[model samples]
Target: MAIDPKYLMESYANPIDYWELFSKSGLSKFPPCVVSVAITGGNQGKESNPNLPETLDEQVQQTYDAYKEGASLVHIHCRCPHDPSTVTDDPEVYRELNRRIRKKCPDIIINNTVIGGKWSRNGVMCPPMNVSIPARPEVGSVDITNYTWSMMRKGRPEYGRPQDTLEEMQYTINKQELEHTLSEMKKYGVKPEFELFDIGDLQYLRDLIQEGKTDPNVPNWVQMVFTPALTYQTPDMLLAAIRHMPKNTVLGIVATGGCQYPFLALALILGCNVRVGMEDGYYVEKGVLAESNAQLVAKIVRIAKELGRPIATPAQAREILGLGAPRMEF
Candidate 1:
């Protein structure tokens, strides 16, 4: 069957209504796929994967390597220099990190985390909100939903730490934090990446758009992070997420742990973008540890290539996400 060029372009523009046309179209009709790599997560560090970058220098190098391997967008979490175990919310730390990163990967989209880092401000644990200042990252993640993150590592000898362990932490971003985060993003011209965990979060975003709290003009970057703790990694869940997404959404899928590879591949087939890195999963494959973030990125790049999906460069990603030119400079 021959596909019309105008119709295919329209399908890319009107993604919500054109899902059938885009997904059913041949390889020639596939839109450029943006590959985002979350270099390091706030929860686990060298303990989970020895290669996980913790210091400022390590992160910059890892990011540059990933960018070379076809990842156009980089999601970052700055670890407190003083306490490497905990994530930092210090604006100065984020500023310095973003500066160093820009020096290395100039055009790659720098996305700082609002919910990844857990630090104490008055002896009370809190997520970072000052990530946009000074750094003014091109993108910053805003977690819309709250849930308990429960995980257990049992007899995983491949990892550096193989001890059987269980962790259950209540993750949240309160109303005040949300207001401040949104205000800061608007102030700095940073694109908001909505971190969603379930179907309800999509509704919450919809309500925000209707309330005029969120800018409806800008395309919504909805990143659905699928984990068994909050939402299962399954086709039904992914499809439901796509079905509930609001109009003008650039959907990105992330599955925690071992499901990352398969989940992202499925996302590619459905004409959605994908995220990969140690933050999401440490292993490149089952029982095979990933040496660096670039390795994970290369794996996905190969998958997208095999599926006939062209990888989006940083410049292309900016256009796809409806972002302006590089805002922050060193």
Candidate 2:
């Protein structure tokens, strides 16, 4: 008997099938985009947003809620009770946070952030200093360019300072620094989530991949961080990133302010994954505060659905990212 087109079309579930359909239709390639919720804003806490997760229980609950709302991955930034504004290098906090979150949502991909900052009383926030991966989570971020990471400059008051007016640390991701983070991550088999701040950062990542520093066995996850200070947020800048984007690697974005809503829409059209939630921006709209991370994730899930793109399960996300079998479920 001849095959039924309806049956064939209805049975398609994976990203490749959708990709083929989009290509055949001559539309912009749209694939299943993985949703990653950055559980907490870098320094935001209850004091500022009141909705920010600071306590261990709150963090775990928020993460679980986000996962249930179709977020397959979570960017885990261990919280410290002392001050919700600065990151804690203490290994205990990282270990506890990772353990609890993993237990809470086994299938949800965990990506730990390695960042530190010195809060200046005078309002000139120092670049996040002493950045380290205290927790050996599934993945950690690796900055690959020279730039400043100021939430203020990006229209997000992470440091709660005036944008571009206060001085911040100039984060230079030199070879030595990259190697150090790599060494630390290797100790725990943690994959590096290389961040692209500009087009050059992409080229640098290419060099590392060629040098065997970034082994191909592990799925490379590159996050494009758009910022005014870095000058890599425009369509032309995105073109530059895709121009040098590495082969067979995951491409995602962390657009700050309310930019994620629009930028994610564009990135999805181009078949790129996404990162959202309070870490990037707390606004569900211009003046409103996000009640929870799940709210942000659901927004993206809805958009992808309307665009005729299926959502990937936790296991599929793991497989797409080349994460190991069994333990890392879909």
CA lDDT scores, all candidates in order? 0.78, 0.68
* Runs with alpha carbons beyond 4 Å of true place in candidate 1: 1-25, 116-134, 152-165
What digit string (tens of lDDT, one per residue) describes model 2 on residues 107-226? 787887763222442354543423435456777776667664443322235545434343354554567767876877787777788877777777787788898887666557888888
TM-score of 2: 0.81
RMSD of each: 5.1, 6.8
RMSD of 1: 5.1
Best of the candidates, TM-score: 1
TM-score, one value per model:
0.87, 0.81
Which segments of model 2 are wrong by more than 4 Å?
A: 1-30, 115-134, 149-167, 326-330
